[model samples]
Target: MLRYTLMRLGIFAGCLVVVWGAVYSGIFPRGFGASNGLWVLLLALVLSAPISWVVLRKERDRASVQIVTKVDRMKANLDANRSQEDVADDSARTQGQPS
Candidate 1:
């Protein structure tokens, strides 16, 4: 998870730097005195999504599988715990009844 997150962050930062460089270098026309900061960030995010999707496919799949496995394990543990509780309850009720 940490590795995946860091990789994503690195991609976003790279996109941001490239976009900023374009705006600073006048590659992207800036009619106003300074380029809009929010617009630049938004463009970077938009550009990063497809790039990340392609570059991080393996890491994304690994993270997804890990999530599914954890969920399945949790469900199994919960079912087991519920069954034990039900058995204990049944035993206690049977003991209280007259033989």
Candidate 2:
């Protein structure tokens, strides 16, 4: 849980850095002064940030499903191997018994 939290924080910081850089570069032109452009940029961020968050959430969910699938496959393989060992053990025990 702590790892996940740290990872999320890192992702947020990286995103903020990228967004700040883009806005500071004056990529979006406004007829008025920089203040108006900054306002527009902030508004766009407020609006689009949720959309970006939702998209990232979806990606995280997909990655989670893949991880779960891999884990389940590993568990199933382990179970099968255990059962085979049990069968072998049982065979050996019976073979040693009196005829």
Candidate 3:
């Protein structure tokens, strides 16, 4: 997960830099003034999404599998603990009753 997150952030930063350079270099029309910054941000977001989706598919899948495995292990541990407690309770109740 950490790796995937870092990669995604890196991709976003790269896209932002590219967009910023393009806008500043006059490749894109510059008459929007304050809105030029907004345009750059929007362009970066749009460009980054598809790139990340294509480039990070494997990392995303690995992270998802890890999460699912961790959840399953925790659930098994909880079930085992509950079963032990139930057995202990039953034994204690039986001992208290007259033979």
TM-score on alpha carbons, each prediction: 0.91, 0.50, 0.83
Where does candidate 1 have its weakest 10-residue lDDT segment?
28-37
List CA RMSD, all candidates: 1.8, 9.8, 2.0
lDDT string for model 1 (1-99, tens) is 788999999999999999889977988754344547876788889999999999999999999999999999999999999999999999999999998
lDDT of 2 by residue, 39-80 (tens): 554655565556556656756676678789999999999999
Misplaced by over 4 Å in model 1 are 31-35
Best by TM-score: 1
Give me the candidate number with maximum lDDT. Answer: 3
Candidate models: Cα lDDT each: 0.90, 0.67, 0.93
The deviation in Å at residue 10 for candidate 2 is 9.1
* lDDT at 82, model 1: 100
Q: Once model 1 is optimally superposed onto the true structure by TM-score, how far is the C-alpha of residue 64 displaced, in angstroms? A: 0.7
**Residue by residue across 1-99, what tens digits does model 3's lDDT show?**
999999999999999999899889988666476798789888889999999999999999999999999999999999999999999999999999998
Q: How accurate is candidate 1 locally (lDDT)?
A: 0.90
List ranges where model 3 is wrong by over 4 Å: 29-33
